[model samples]
Target: MAGVGSEKVFENDKVIVWNFVLEPGEETPVHTHEHSYMWYAIEGAPLHIYDKDGADLGIFEVPTGAVYSLKCQDGYLEVLSEIGKGARVPATHKARNDGDRPYREVLVEYKDAMPAGGSV
Candidate 1:
């Protein structure tokens, strides 16, 4: 796998923050996310998503300062169950900058939490 061009700026019990940057024509290597996350685009541009096999998924128009959130495919119960059973799985994907300018964003990742009622 290649490397992701991002740095961990902060982390705490509740969340982890990352400072992501990518120059024009640059790309992020295949990466996985174990927790839910949202991103605020500092300098957005067109981007292309690709699979692990290098197949193009699609292109997206990212607007400057736009914010977006994504939930892990595994639900809360699934995550806990996987942990309990000693299984680790993460959502994987790769991204490429297709625009002329650099792309930057602040990514905030949420920590795992139990249900409010203490049950699934």
Candidate 2:
């Protein structure tokens, strides 16, 4: 997805912080993040789409006020090492808030990697 009202500001390391508001049924494509990112659900349950090897796997519904951390590790196993990796890390996720209100949250801290880049 192209940059709309998006903002890409970096904190430190190779991490790029992405902050924006996605409209209903509107979202950013599956682009890989440079570093893993921590995502928090603020307003609604955002529908997150995951893809691997150019295939859409499934949709993950993240409710409001939910907090998650990611560290772009290799293969599927690395994705499970949340505690082992310790604290915040790079990760990819698609969130959708289905409630009547909009979804919002502050990704406490996580590595930023390139999101797949585009909707399914």
Candidate 3:
């Protein structure tokens, strides 16, 4: 299966770190997030989203230096903080850079925080 990010930068028993980068007009492969994860944006951009079936979701703004934590189960994701509390979306999806500059982020997935019976 494809990873959730562009590249696997590091991994240990507790977590995996990824360096995700998207050039202008580039898109990632449809991927799944099975464990809880967090990401820090290095560069900001508007990202167009598509579900696993290639259905368009919408454009999401990613602000530089922003961070987000999410929990996943059965291909659905829930925001872990109060800022976007009660919101959930499909976890199996792809992101396309819809801006002129490259978008970059550092993502970390918590292996220990996986839902019961979950595996990467």
Candidate 4:
């Protein structure tokens, strides 16, 4: 939950936070998000794909320190659920769905935040 509630702290056109690193030879399998994403590749090279229902959508390469935002409108990524709500992804630094795909990222979703004039 990140200790956040369903309330407005402020308003914005959009917001997201994340960090990622990849060792040589890695990729993140096709996945979906409910909010949206601006994937900023911090370190290492990564190959990203937008997929829906086990089908191919599009392929993207995110190099170190790059950013990309993905949404259902962009393509069909069979969204299973929303982020920061109830859907929980398996904590990384642990499992592997399929070998050869090792995309990693630190994610933060839009939610209630510090009020105005609040120090972060």
Candidate 2 lDDT, 20-102, residue by residue in tens: 56666565554444434555556545454544333444445566665555545552213322332333222343333334555
Q: After superposition, how far is residue 7 of candidate 3 from its true place, in Å?
A: 2.4
Q: Residue 84 in model 2: shift from native, Å?
A: 16
Q: What's the lDDT for residue 100 in model 1? A: 96
TM-score for each candidate, following the candidate numbering: 0.76, 0.55, 0.85, 0.38
Q: Rank the candidates by TM-score, best first.
A: 3, 1, 2, 4
Q: Write the per-residue lDDT of candidate 3 for residues 1-111, one digit (tens) a residue.
A: 245577898999988899998999999888887778878889989989889999988887888887877887777988765444556779888889999999999988888
Error of 2 at 72 (Å): 0.4
In the range 36-57, model 4's lDDT, one tens digit per residue, is 3333444423343323333433
List the global CA lDDT of all models: 0.67, 0.45, 0.80, 0.35
Q: Native-vs-model 4 lDDT?
A: 0.35
State the displacement of the C-alpha of residue 74, model 4, in Å, after optimal TM-score superposition.
9.7
lDDT of 1 at 3: 46
RMSD to native for every prediction?
A: 8.2, 8.2, 4.2, 11.5
Q: Per-residue alpha-carbon lDDT of model 1 for 1-120, expressed as tens digits?
A: 114638888889988888889899988888876666667789998888776678776776778977765556563212222112322233576788999999999877778743243212
Model 1, position 17, has a per-residue lDDT of 85
78 Cα displacement, candidate 1 (Å): 16
**TM-score of model 1 (CA atoms):** 0.76
What TM-score would candidate 2 get against the native?
Answer: 0.55
Candidate closer to the true structure by lDDT (higher is better), 2 or 3 = 3
